[model samples]
Target chain A: MKAYRLRRGAGRTALYIAVIAVSLMYLLPLFWMVRSSLMSAGEIFLIPPVWIPNPPRWSNYTKALTTIPFGRYFLNTMKIVVFNLLGTVLSSSICAFSFARLRWRGREFFFALLMSGMMLPGAVTLIPTFLGWRAVVPPNSYLPLIVPAWFGGGAFNIFLLRQFMRGIPLSLDEAALVDGASYPRIYAQIILPLSKTPLIVVSLFQFLGVWNDFLGPLIYVNRERFFTLALGLQMFIGYYTAQWELLMAAATIVLVPPVILFLLGQKFFTRGIAISGLKG
Target chain B: MRKEEAYGYLMAAPAILGFFIFTLGPLLASLWLSFTDYSVTNVYKFVGLANYKRLFSGADPFFYKSLGVTLYYVALSVPITIVSSFLMALLLKQKFKGRGLVRVIVTMPSIVPAVAVATIFLWLLNPDIGLFNEILRALHLPTSQFIYSETTVVPTLAMMNIWTMGSTMLIFLAGLENIPEQYYEAADVDGGGPIYKLFHITIPMMSPTIFFNLIMGLINGFQTFTQAYIMTEGGPNNASLFYSVYLYREAFTNQRMAVACALAWVLFVIVLLLTLVVFRTSGWVYYEGDRQ
Candidate 1:
């Protein structure tokens, strides 16, 4: 028994060492990005490379921000992100509530249709959708990006919220019904409040999706003034190919909001992913 | 009952409408457009499968080339991602110190924006004055011109892809957790070693999750565009011209909207067929509840 305990202790110690080493490997690129952002241009290109900046240059951020219209890009991204969150949360929850709580005709059929929609790759509809939007709105308008969210959020978001709503006790809605509360009232009060965790998860997912979307902006937006942060960064890289320090600075800035959101709501994020995997 | 039905329809109306307009409508329109000669100049002529004929008749070499590139990417990246994420999940499953922090570090890259991923990797993989090459030199190994060289661009992108295996890893972790500890306890009583338990227990139990990841990974891999678009733009002799990127170029750049539509339908057919094949052959996938 003593020998077994000693072996188990040694095994755990070795596991800790291995985990720490692998964690460092996973984090090294992010560390290098931050480190490079604070170094001088010449320091970045040094033969043996600087592991850490001797005196970190805080001005690289300022230079990078000023070099492009990052402020405008940030505002554009924020506007889209906010609208996307509202649209996804409002629309997905409503649709999900119906699927979960209400007795309706063709409910299962429509739900199956929604699930099938997830399998259709975006490329299949890229052109006609572009033409459909281009006919009504001018090129580079935010409508194409923002308006789709207002529709039914998205198939995935609806599916996620529906899954979460199904887990809520049916007795709550029945109680509300006994008090002569309408379906909308039940959805707004009982269902919405109870489903807060999944709602936040859906919103966070939408925020990340809109914030990091590149292909949508790339397809719809043409002019530089209408570019989101992702598009602006791409344009920045095109013009400043050799400017690694400033580029890293700009990339780091683009990375901040999602990282902050992840840090704040890591639990919901993991739970959401795990639930999706199981159901999927 | 009628009132409740109305409420359900009303609640689901917006999504249904959006589905019809944005998804279903475009899907049908694409099929119609694929046979025509549609371009940006508002000229649409029904050419009766000419675009598809072009795709097959060697008139458009880029179509086949892009398809090949996408297939290669899917083949390379999906297996690597599955194996690596499974291993990572197995590691994280252990009761070690600071395991939570390590899991977070590993999973963080998946949330990092693709544009930023492309940007960071562009510098990291630079042949000169790059971290990877520097490390290689330190170890007295040959440095590679990753992503820049024609031969290594796809593989390098595959490597970059493996860095974001956090989501799949988490899925595997979830799967691992679902596994009953009784299996391992039985294995222990049976005098099974580590490798014996791994093969006889862990792998068979986790097969369903592995299958799920494989399907999703294949789908996503075929749709890979943003990183290749940002980093290489299918350059250095079009070594990295993925199917979607090529389709996009045909639509927007070359003004061949009809051809692009045709390409889209082809991709749809291929993905659907592959998915169907997997579903048909997935008899080996073991689910916990279905004891058969």
Candidate 2:
């Protein structure tokens, strides 16, 4: 028994060591990102490549941030992201409530139709949608970008929330209906508050999606001041192609928020992906 | 109970309206435009099947090259992603200290903005001074230009797919959790080895999630644009010119709107056909209720 216990302990130790080794290998590139950000431009391309940056240049971050309209781009991204969050949450929840909570004719049919939208790649509609927006909106406006969020968010989001809302015990809504609660009231009071997890998940996904979106702004927003961080970063690269140190610094600045968001909302992000994947 | 069919439509009106405006309307418009010679600067004229003819006739230099590049990329990425993420999930599935922290670290790369990822990789794969080449030099191994070479560009981008397989790994982890321990114990009772249990228990049960990831990976693979646009610009001889990149160049750069619309329809048809094939052949996927 003592020898058997010793063998099991040995197995556990080996497993832990193996895991640690794999984990470091996985994080090497990201660690390199941060390390590269701090290095002087010459040090970045050092032939021997020292692991640590000598006399870490803190000015790189400032220089990177100030080199162009980084602040303006950051603000533009935040503005777009904020409106998207509001519109997606408000509209999608309402749509989900209609499917999950309200009694209706052709409910399942509409849902089936909506779910089919999931399979339709955005690429199919990219051309016509661009044409559609360009006809009405001014060349430099953000209307085309922001206004679409008012409509249904996206089919997958509605489906995710509807799925979650369905699992929230129809009895609660029945109880509320008995109390003469209006459909709007029930949606606002009961479903919205109860469906926080999926909402956060959807919002987090939306935040990241809009934050990192490149193609949309690339096609629409040609003005430098209207550019999102992703577009701005691309523009920065286009001109300063060889400014490796500053580029790394700029990349780090853009990367930090999403990394922090993922860490803080790790559980929600995992749950969201899992729910969508498994039930998909 | 009060009947609320009117209210149901009323509340869901925004989404319904959006479906018409955003999805169905554009889909039909794009279809029509495919059959027309619609350029932004000129008045439109009907040109039946000419755009489609141009695509397959080898008249357009970019059409076949883009299609081949996209297929090559999808073929490389999908299997590698499924296998690697599954293995990562299995390793993380084991009970260990600080597993959560380790999983987070492993996945941290996925959340980085794609542009930033492209920027970093641009330098990291730089022929002379990149970290990868430096490491290769240290190990006394031969190094080649990764994304700079036409033959290597797609494969290199496909390898980068591994970096963003975090969400896929999480999905696999969730699917792994759903597999009951009883089957594993039953297999153990019969003196089955780890490999036997893996083949019999874990994989069969996880087949549905694997199938889901496979479809999603392929679908997203078809839409891959940012990396090529940012890194290669479909260059080193248009070797990496993705279909979307080609489409964008035609539509936005050249203002050949009708040709671009035709490209979009071709992509839509291809995806529809591929989805049909994948679904029809998904008999290997085992649901929880399926009998052995």
Off by over 4 Å in 1: A1-6
**For each candidate, what's the DockQ?**
0.83, 0.79
Interface RMSD of every predicted model, in angstroms: 0.8, 1.1
The residue-by-residue lDDT of candidate 2 on B62-180, one tens digit each, is: 99999999999999999999999999999999999899999998787888899999998998888898888888998999997999998899999999978888989999999999889
Q: Write the per-residue lDDT of candidate 2 for residues A1-280, one digit (tens) a residue.
A: 9997999899899889879987887787777878988998788877788789889999999998888778999999898899988999999999999998787888888888888888887888999999999999899677778888889988889988998998988888789989999878888999899999999999999998888888989999998888889998998899888888888888988988888999999999989988888565
lDDT of 1: 0.91
Q: Write model 1 residue lDDT over B153-271, tens digit each, in one string.
A: 99999988778888899999999999999999999999999999888899989988889888888788889999999999997789999999999899999999999999999999999
User: Model 1: iRMSD?
Assistant: 0.8
lDDT of each: 0.91, 0.89
